[model samples]
Target chain A: MKVVYLDNNATTQVAPEVLEAILPYFHDFYGNPSSMHAFGGQIGAHIRTAREQVASLLGAHPDEIIFTSCGTESDNAAIRSALYADPEKRHIVTSRVEHPAVRALCAQLSGQGYRITELAVDKDGRLDMEQYEQSLTPDTVLASLMWANNETGVIFPVEKAAAIAREKGILFHTDAVQAAGKIPIDMGKNTIDMLSISGHKLHAPKGIAALYVRKGTKFSPVMVGGHQERGRRGGTENTPSIIGLGKACELARQNLSQENTQVKKLRDRLETALLNAIPKSRINGDTEHRLPNTTNISFEFVEGEGILLMLDLYGICASSGSACTSGSLQPSHVLRAMGVPFTMAHGSIRFSLSIYNTDEDVDMVIEKLPPIIERLRSMSPYWTGDK
Target chain B: MWEYTDKVREHFLNPRNVGEVENPDGVAEVGSIACGDALKLTFALDENQRIKDIKFKTFGCASAIASSSALTEMVKGMTLEEAQKVTNQDIAAYLGGLPQEKMHCSVMGKEALEKAIENCLGVTETSADETAGHIICECFGVTDQDIERAIQENRLSTVEEITNYTKAGGGCGSCREAIRGIIDKIQFEMTPQTAAKAKLSNIQKIKMIEETLEREIRPSLKLDGGDIELIDVDGNRVMVATRGTCATCKAADITLKHFVEKRLRDLVSPDLVVEEVTQ
Candidate 1:
């Protein structure tokens, strides 16, 4: 079967270059980075290079990059460290559309006595800047928001949001897991105190991620152990995965333009073709501001999970914000937050492409998806097609 | 991805009956676009009042569409009486089995079939109005009676299970407490008079105790930099120990008697007594 994978925002296939760069660490540099021996010490230099490589991608200081297990760990560490550092500031604010890494943690924090303000988004999945500004209270410790929505791929004004928090003397963090590789992010010019990136999203192996903490940001550690990550994150370093992540980041920096151009064109073609082919279908999220690789489309009356199953049979991989796909009865919280009608919300499908995807993949999807939607719609009780 | 059965996949890929019966003797629709899945069922009756043909138009997940497809095949040649005997379980069983969370899809198929039979008989057994029953779940528009029937039939014990069977507390979770209350009421009704005295399992008792303390007692205690922990639940007596400021508060005994005891009685069994276990 020819697999047509379009669920890149979930996780991605590890780039061959990244895998080649990482595999040798398992055999040659198996010595712990924290060991006193020269074998380990030599490994540390490579790690330093890896740090610099990741730093170069974000335009961050090498000293500021803290490698964690994944984006969830990075997000947890960022929010907890900020709150722990500023115990007096009991209020925390974030956008409602944040990935569960931030949203669930913040929700738990609210139960633990810290105030949480989840800022709402508009119909286009764009955050309200005015409300964001008002949300920064005197005791606001930090404001964490995502750079892009995983489901909708709607980009946020995170740089401006970070600046607003910076003006209020509040620590700002952005979970840039979905944003970092797709969009150009230069920390040197931005006011974001902390930014998170998951390695797998950018073609590195899973279970490796980095948090970019601005130089001299008041730091507190989520996990304290042996002197690693400059005592920011602990436990012996994930040597191979970290190296892989750094390689992925370097590749991401190099492919930034290609990602925006070739990948964007493929994504646009997929969306435009899908919309044209399917009736009563409309795109979710803001068309002008989405990530270059993603397009969320809703085929009304025909549920998403049904369409996904049909697509799966054809070896096409994608994801859905529909109720069934969410492992819960409700539709995607991001779509629900945007006030998307239930009719469309249950049928919303997210097609996120990657640099590896070609025109054939997009065209194949365009040809395959319409028949599936039509078949499901023909069976749909509410679908009269006359409307 | 859902672990769909091979039978479900087969039915979904090549549904047995995919079109409506022409000039059908009966027709019915259940669910709506807002509800995420729906089914429109139609059937024609022969001279002997036997179902000559049956077909369905369904909008939902694979299981939902497959269940509808399976239901049509199951009822095609059966009499209306035999068709009326079809349950949600029958539909799911015809397609091997559906995921427990997707049981509602089969349930929808059964309901649509029942409504189709009712349409033929000009009966008023099933009502789809919001006024017919008080809406407990505003998100799915599930009513109190709908929830009660689902509980009784499915033997659902948890709000999560109730949601899986009927999508009651599956939305914003605002109706979670209401759903829990209904589950509790249904369980109590089924409990024998003698069983009511010891209705809760050890797991259930511990869960109920922990939930009561966390929901009712923990917040006020935590606000005072204090906390309560359930040491053990031994029959009707709940052994608890306090931590933080709660351990040494001057009003500790009064707080235990007045606050903890009252809440435990209201939510859990009335006979539950909170006894503080000293460190």
Candidate 2:
């Protein structure tokens, strides 16, 4: 059976054009971009062109795009730089539902004496603006927000948040790893001082990402020793992968308008069929603001892992709410943060679509999934007669 | 997913005698969602005190659900007394063996059975009396005097070695210091430093090791119906092979780690590692 790949939120398959552009760099055109020799100077020109392509996607200046290893590294650099820029200020503000990369980093910083205020979100995974406003003080140095949540696919008001942070004179950073390619982002139009983006979330390979730092922003390098990215990010460039990311960004920008509409329709059809065929199954986040290509739902009484296993047997790729933390058995922290009850939390699953998905793929999923849920629910002890 | 044994998967997927008996002679319930699992056990008792039918309803992980199912299957033809002796280890052993972390699920089954038995007796099950005159282990506040007498009477080797005989020091490990205190006091009184000068012969040392194992370790394992055999004697370092209920028990490592080693080290020599001889 052909596998239906629906875990785009976790990562996306590299686009064909992006892969073709990157292959030449690995063998025939291989050269050190920093090398002064003619053989290497040609590769350095490709790097500049790639940077401009990525910059165009985000409406950022080519100089603002500083390549990093991955989204987490970019988030780390941005948050750490904000702290370094204003050492006297000791407060940071962020949301409770941030991905572990940001959440864990903030948690570690909190232990090191930074007073972090984790703003709470409402049931739809939207943050409270009132709490965001109250969290700011003279000591607040940064407001780190995410453009979109990886788990629920709920979009945050990043532009409004940047405006708020600007009024407070606090630097704003966004982990836009999930939003960069899926949605329209114009950093030039927003008040965002810094933003983080990853390659894997788009149609680019892993291990390459970038941090966009607006010009004239007070910046400090978290990683020292090398002069790469103009001493802003210090690491030997991952030439092939970075080149792939740039090409992927260009393709995503080219096809985004049409692919977004097509993928959204596929997602909608899948959601509609599953909800109609199964009782008590509904979307988990605000439908209107959620990513057009992602859908998270809960099937009451049936556990997510059990359904996932059955789906796995049929060659379907998906994600569940269970997080294997070092030796503790608990449901997802994200679902729990949203105040989802334990009974329903274990039943939540995420299906993130990509441009590679098709109407037939949606139809196959719609045809195959309800029976799997029905089979698992039949064996569940908590199943009510309504099901 | 848990790497469940074939037997465990079979029991969980097609669990035996699930759901409650309409009119049960006795009912036993233990654990709750707070503890991550809960079981409701019901039994149909025969005139001869045999279990005519056994049924259970469990809301837990796969191992927990499987343990309950396997327990219900094992106890149907057993007398109430025989069923009472069917320990958590027997439940785990019946299902090929559970992972160490899921050992608590099998234990929950035993607790539910015992609770059902106590319920059948119509006397409120005695809470393991928290505020009492009996002093166990000072480390975990297990009443020393009660647990000490139980240890002497029951022949317990180590502290977790005693959880089978007495549910102390199993929570938070605060009572271990108190247990060590008592063990030190007893050793000091029994083997006074002068006894070391008396020169324990190699035969006597070996006999002392045998006595400690037979008296202390075996009985504790028997509570779970597990047994251990002496593999070889090498001065203070002893090798033992766990068997029966313990051979495949998940906490068999915990048994060897905290209990077996501590006992042999205290009774035989301080240099004992208590290595397990596989097969």
Candidate 3:
């Protein structure tokens, strides 16, 4: 089967250059970055270079980047550090559309007596800045929001939101897992105190991620062990994966413009072709303010899982926000927060592209998806063709 | 991805009898768009009153479509009685067993079959709102009767199991306590206790009544600024005193009989009655 993978926001295919760069570290240079031996100490230099590479992509200082297990750990470390720094502040402000890493942690915090203010989004999955500003209080310890929603690809004004939080002397964090590689991020020009990036979301291997903590931010270590990651994160370095992430980040910087131009064109082409080919279909998020390489479309009167399965038969990979896909009776929380009708919410499919995606990939999905939607719609009791 | 059986995938990919029968004798729809799945079933009967041609149109996941497809194939050429005997389990068994979460798909199939049969038999041409059984899970529009039927038919023992089978408590979960009440009621009824069974000792009866009050009745009562304290348990008359707002509330007696007594009967024993001891 000629697999046409479009589920890049979920995870991306590791670039060949990244794979090749990391293989030598796994075999020849397989030494603990923390070891006393020269062979191992040499790996430390490479780790520093990797940190610089990641920092360069985000426009941040190398010393501020701390590698962790994955995006979830980075999000956890950032949120926990904010709370730990300001223990007196019992309230936290976050969006309702956050990924579970931040949302679940906020939920757990709410149970432990900390207040959580989950700001709502508009019908376009765009946050109401006035509501966000009103949500912050003197008691608010931090404000955590996502740079881009994983499901809908809607981008939030995290930089502007962070500035608002900063004015209130509140720490701000952004789960940039979905935003980092696909979009250009300049931490130096922003007020975001902490940002999270996952390796696998780009073209790096899994099990590696980075948390960017501003140089002067009051920080607390979530994982305390030996002086690894300058005691911010404590674990023997995932040397090979880190090296892979470095190469991935370097490549991401080079391909950033191509992502916005070529990948975005493919995504738009696919979205436009599908909407033209299929009736009763619409985009889920703000098309103008979304990730460059992502498009979430809803085919009414048909369930998403069925569309995805039929797509799978043609070796086309994608994802959905449907309840059946998530194993929950309710549809996607992001869509629900945006007040998307259940009729369309159950059938929303997210097609996230990447640098690797070509015109053929987009065309293949365009060619294959409309028929699948028509087939499923034919089976739907609600589908009356005209309506 | 769901570990859907190959049979389920097969049926879903190439669903049999996909469409409605023309001028069908029996036609019905189960589930709704809001609930993320719905099925419309139509069947024509042969002169001998057996199902000659049956077809389904479903709007749901792969498993749901497959279950509907599998159902039309299973019931074709069968008498209405035999088709009525087709359980959701049988549908799932035919598909080599669905994932536990997708069991509701098969249940939807069974409900569609039963309703279509009722339509054929002229029981109700309008297809009595499938959701007409006292809506328990408002999000999913699942009913208490729906939960009870799922529990009884699937031998479900937990609230999660009921959700899997009927999507009763799979939403906001505010109805979980109500679902637990239904589960307790059905399990107690199915316990095989008869009139000839061993009688409960006084101590055992008192302990059971107290347990029911604490476990079931009190929490719900407290939610409404009320509380119940077990005063005594003599024979089947369990005495309880309402504290807080419940003591002076206008609906105290109604609470005593409907809420308190019903819970006691459902959880401890069916014969038990609740009486409030006025201060």
Candidate 4:
């Protein structure tokens, strides 16, 4: 059927090289890195090397990276731990467009006597720096923000936010799950005290993520148990996935430049064709400042789920802004926060590219999508006028 | 991947009768893509009052697309009267079975067929005037009397309960207030002065839920005509039985979690939990 996958923001297929790197740990190299046996000691060396590989990608020291279960876990740990690290400060500043992993958790914290200031974003999904600056207070303990939005792919000014927070002596954490592999990130120079990365967002398997706590930064362990990652995290090490993530990070560092140029061009080509071919279609975020491999577009008078189903029929995978959460009738909160009209919000579709996607795949979507949208619009009562 | 039945898979994979018919005798459409689906039905009527051909174009999920395909194939050689009688249930039965939430897909087909018939007859596709006036379930534009009768016919128990029989008030829910008004009107009409003297009874509430389900919610699911079973009764907690199509629907969770649970809780009991029975 010649399936074409474009839903990279949701999750990515494991890369062959990353798979090869992880296979050895599953078979002959299986051993607890914490044990005193020779086999365990040998595997411990491999774990150290993997740690270095991941650290190199983020431009952090080897001891700074602590592996977690996933991006959500890391986000929870970072935000909650920041408050614990500085108990006197009962205020937190963040943006409204953060993933539910952060937003929902923050909302939960709001019930526990913590004052949260949610900064607003512009219509194009860009955070308002002026509003962010004004929201900061002496009581603000942490400024947790995302490097890039999952739904819109709009890049946030992490460096600026970190600098502002550092000037105020407030700790900063950036959920870089979507930005880690797709963009150039040098955490060491950004004043970013803490950062989070998810393996599934790249090509490593799900249930593997890492938290980057810069050396000398105050951090409290969210999980309490064993002395893994120097007690920063607890539980038996997910050796295979950790190793996979390390390999994925190394690959990311190697291919990031090529991806920025080549993958970005492919994504742009797909966006251009879609916007040119489909009537009443417009891009959802700032095209110039988004992730190289991501694009979101709204097809007016057409619902996202229907468009997604049509694309599914053609063996083209993507995501939508329609009711992103499990049960809510409303569309994506990111779009809603951007003040996007309800009609347009429901019609938005996200197409995220990866190194694996090709021109032929984009061409297939370009060929198949217009007729589907036109056909759907023809039946729409709301789209009575010329499209 | 979902375990789609061979019939469902076939309809989804190689959908029958897709795309719009060019300048047809009559075109009937429902469920726009924005509403998660849209259908365009074109039919040719013969001199003998039978349908010569029926073609459809649908933009929706697998169930909706498949239901429309199955429906166009099912009604090709039937008379307008016979086609009008072809319910979403009949469509689901023909396709072996559909999931419960997808049942709305089949109901969409029935609605399209009815609308097509109305279009063919040179009449403005008005609401049925049998025992009902145009007391549309403003949320989804379903009539009042139709809801009243559906409640008596289907034994519906709650507002979410009605979606299984009729697809009323299933839209944006702006129509629910109107539905409530209609319910009170029907009750008052049933017992003139007693309406003012007596409080609305539990039986009356349950009856209203049944009517809403049959007239409004059910028809929507019937588009795919997946069977929804009434599981059990525990005080206000009504356990539903979803089989055939609904038994394995992906959004069956969504149907049970949001649509079914919310509607029932809002209209009948706020503490109700419309749980899906594990197979």
Candidate 5:
């Protein structure tokens, strides 16, 4: 079956260029970057170049880019570093619709006596700027928000929010896991203190991510071992994946415009066609303010897992915010936080596109998805075919 | 993705019975749209009072639809009594076992069958009143009885398992303590003699008060054309309501303090007080 891969926000296909760039690092150049021998020490130069490449993508100094295992680690390091840097401040400000990486960590912090002000979102999954501004207090050590939501693809005004946090003298971090590669970001233009980027979200292999810390930010190390990553992070580097990530970042920078134009068109096409063809369906996020490559649509009455399984039969990949899909009896926290009606929230499907997606892929999804929805709705007890 | 067996995939892809039967003898609806799953089942009876035809309409996940489909196929030619014997485990086994988290789907099939049978027998109202225990999980509309039954049927040992089977603690989780209380009570009952020797927790005490009311006091009250309902158990104070003739009887307070309190103190704990609340 031809896989019409649309679930790019979850992960992306590793680019051939990235694979080629990392091949030699595995076998012939299998030497630690920290070794004293020249054969291994020369690998450090490549690592520097990789760091510079990643830094260039984020518009940060090469010294500010710290390579970590993945997005979760980057998020953890950034949030914990802020808290550890300011022990007197016991309050943290964040949004309710964050990815589990940040959301779960904040929850744990709350259990440990840190006051967390989880700002609520509007019905369209857009955060209220006034509520956000009010959430930042003098005692708030950090305000960690996501640049874009993984489930709904709603892009937050992180740069604007960061400026507000800056006025309050609070550290601001953004988990750009879903936003980094798809959108253009320049650290030089924003007051953001730190940002996290995952490689797998950008056609790079998994197990590689970068944390961009602004210069002169008070940092505390999460992993305390080797003096690697200038003591900001520990452990030996994932050499080949890091190199691959560098290549992927270069490709992402080159393809950024294509992502905004070509991928956005495919996403809009799929969204428009599906909504037109299917009744009792609506988009789940703020469409105008969302990522260019993603759309979340809810097919009411039918469950999301049923729709996903039917789509799987046709070799079309997507994801859902349904309770059954996540093994929790409630729909996704993101959807629930947005105040989406439970009827629609139960059947929310997210279709995230990438630069590799084509018009044919969009067309294939449009052709296969409506019938699947019709079939599920037909079987649904609540679907009376009235709407 | 869930590791659904080929059988589950088969039934989900091509569900056996997809719609309602015309002028069906038995019909039932379980779950709700807000709960993220619901099922409507209908059946027609044959000459032998067997289920001649059965159909289901489910708004849920793959496992839920497959379970409903598999259920109608399983109970086709069976009598209502035999069909009543069909457990959620049977439906799950029919699909080579559902994922533990998705076990509630099979439970929904079983509940729909039970309710449909009650609808056929014309005793749904009585059964509904009996099963209308206090709502423990407000998010899922799961009653205490529902959680207890799921625990007993599935041999569930933890609150997480109860959620898997009945969706009791799968939402805001405010009812987790209530679910834990139910589990403790059932576990205590499973090993009653052993639990009796140990110092009772507050939940165990509440369970004992309920058990004593149902077993010792209610039957005696019913013998006199009256009934009783356990209202609340707060510490040593047990609040109950005399129902039917007992509610208006002049000796209701005497019966509460003398018979009910005395029986509870003897059977459950030494320091027990029963107070009758007029409804």
Candidate 6:
């Protein structure tokens, strides 16, 4: 059975172009980029080209891009480095809807005497700017927020938020793992001091990501062993994955228009069809200001796992924000923070698409999903037809 | 996810008795939609008082639905007496077995079954809960007796296991310390876990209180130009009358709470609460 892959926010299938671009690094050019010999000298040029390629996608300089293991590592390095640069300011601010990468780190920092003010989101997952402005005090060192939420596709006003932090002489960073490929991100136009990017969220293989640090930002290193990436990062570079990531970013920059047009249409169509076919199903985020390739819908009166298991029978891939799906007793914290009802939150399903998806895949999903919802609702004891 | 058993998958895919009995002799609902899982159980009894028809409505994960479905099938021909004996383990065992974290789904099944049986027998006596012991976990509305029963039935060891099995410390987790203490006390018969703690009878409590005042408190009080006398020992509170300088101290309340209470709490059972009595 052909698998209809839609859980792209979780991870994406590696593009053929990216694979072909990095294939030579594994065999013929296996020499370390740091060595003095010609064999390594040739590899050094490739690394520089890859760095430039990655920087080009973000509209940043090659010097500003520091490759790390993945988005979580990039987020870790950026937040910790910002705190290190300003030792006196012990307050940090972020949003309630942050990915666990930033949320967990800020929580750990809070235990070490650093105060955290988590800004809340409105019902549609939009951040409140008034509360955000109030949270920025003289003691705040940095504000880490995500450009777009992973669960809901709602895009935050990061550029405006960055300018807010800038007025206070505080650092600003965004985990752009979900937004970098799916939307237009010009680092040259934004005041964000740092931004994190992941490889697998785009069409690159996992284990490679980059942190874009604005030139001349106060610097520190999260990993401190060897002199790699100009001592901003340490340990050996994952050479093949770096090459793959560079290629993936180049492709993402090229396909940004297509993603906005073609992929967005498919997502909208799927959302519309699901909503029309299945009653009490509604989208979870602000539809106008969201990523182009994502939709999270809740099918009320049916459990998420039951819906997912039934979807799996037809080789359809998706994800859920249900408590049972996550092995915890509560649904997604992002949904809860938005004050989504307990009835809707537990049945929320996220279907994140990618460039590889076709209209046929969308059609297949629209055809197969409504019946699954109907089936689960039929078995549900609480469900009545009126709702 | 969760590594669900093949039997669990089968039962969830083709659930049995997925509706309510029209005129059920017994009906009960357990859990709530807010906590993410709930079950509404209804059963009809034959003229022989055996369960002739049983059905369920559940809004939960696969394990919860599967467990409910399995519970109905197991009790179809059994009398109310036999069905009342059904444990959470029996529900899990009926469907091969559930993941350890998903064990609460089976627990919900058993609770709903027990309540339904109570409804059938007209037994409104919720003895464990109606007597209303202190609620340990307010997040899930778990009572002290609920935690104790879960531990006793499932042999739960850690606070995490208690959350997975009973959802006691799963939310907010402010009750973790209370749950941990309960687990320790229940794990050890006479509070052998702590030398300061013991299962003292009323006479032993009085003797220990006098001995504690004579040994640990009076000597320290005498050194400070003050003294303490044990007046009464009722439950955990040790009512005491301060003598000499302690009686006229400006910070007498602080002396009773911080100095006296702290010392007694550290030396005797940690559950002890100290108070000053009127002379």
- lDDT minimum window of 10 residues, candidate 5 chain B: B190-199
Please report the candidate that would top DockQ against the real structure.
3
Q: Which stretches of candidate 1 lie over 4 Å from their true place?
A: B125-132, B193-279
Give a tens-digit lDDT track for model 2, residues A225-275.
688888887777889998999999998898778556988888888888888
Pairs of residues at least 3 apart in sequence or in different chains that clash in candidate 1:
none
Could you give candidate 2's per-residue lDDT for residues B1-279 as a string of tens digits?
567798987887678988777788889877543333568898888888888888887755667778999999998988878888887778989999986556657777877787787777675645533333475533234466645644554344465555533445554456776776665666555544424533567787778778889876787788688999988888666788999979988999999989888866666666667888897
- Can you give the lDDT of residue A149 in candidate 4? 90
User: For each candidate, what is the lDDT?
Assistant: 0.88, 0.79, 0.91, 0.78, 0.91, 0.89
- True A-B contacts kept by model 6: 0.71
Show pairs that collide, candidate 5: none
Model 4 lDDT tens row, B1-279: 334477976886567776566666777876543344567788887778777777876655566667888888888888888887887778888888875445556777777887788788776644434434775755344566557765544333345534434456555566666666655555445443433323445565456456545544565466566656555555566677676677778878787767666655555555556766665
DockQ of each: 0.60, 0.13, 0.66, 0.13, 0.63, 0.49
Candidate 5 runs further than 4 Å off? B193-279
lDDT by residue (tens digit), candidate 4, A1-387 = 878999999999999999998998888889998889998778888878889989999999989999999999999999988999999999999989999888999899999999998888889988888888888899999999999999889999999999999999999999999999889889767899999999999899999999999888988999988999999899989999999999999999999997789999999899999998887888888877899999999888766766777788889999888742222334677887888776677778999999999889999999999988876665444565453
Tens digits of lDDT, candidate 5, A199-285: 999999999999999999998889888988998888998889999999999999999999888989888889999999999999998
User: Deviation in angstroms for A236 in model 5?
Assistant: 1.0
Q: Model 4 chain B, poorest ten-residue lDDT window?
A: B191-200
lDDT by residue for model 3 over A173-213, one digit each (tens)?
99999999888999989999999999999999999999999
Q: TM-scores of all models?
A: 0.86, 0.76, 0.87, 0.72, 0.87, 0.86
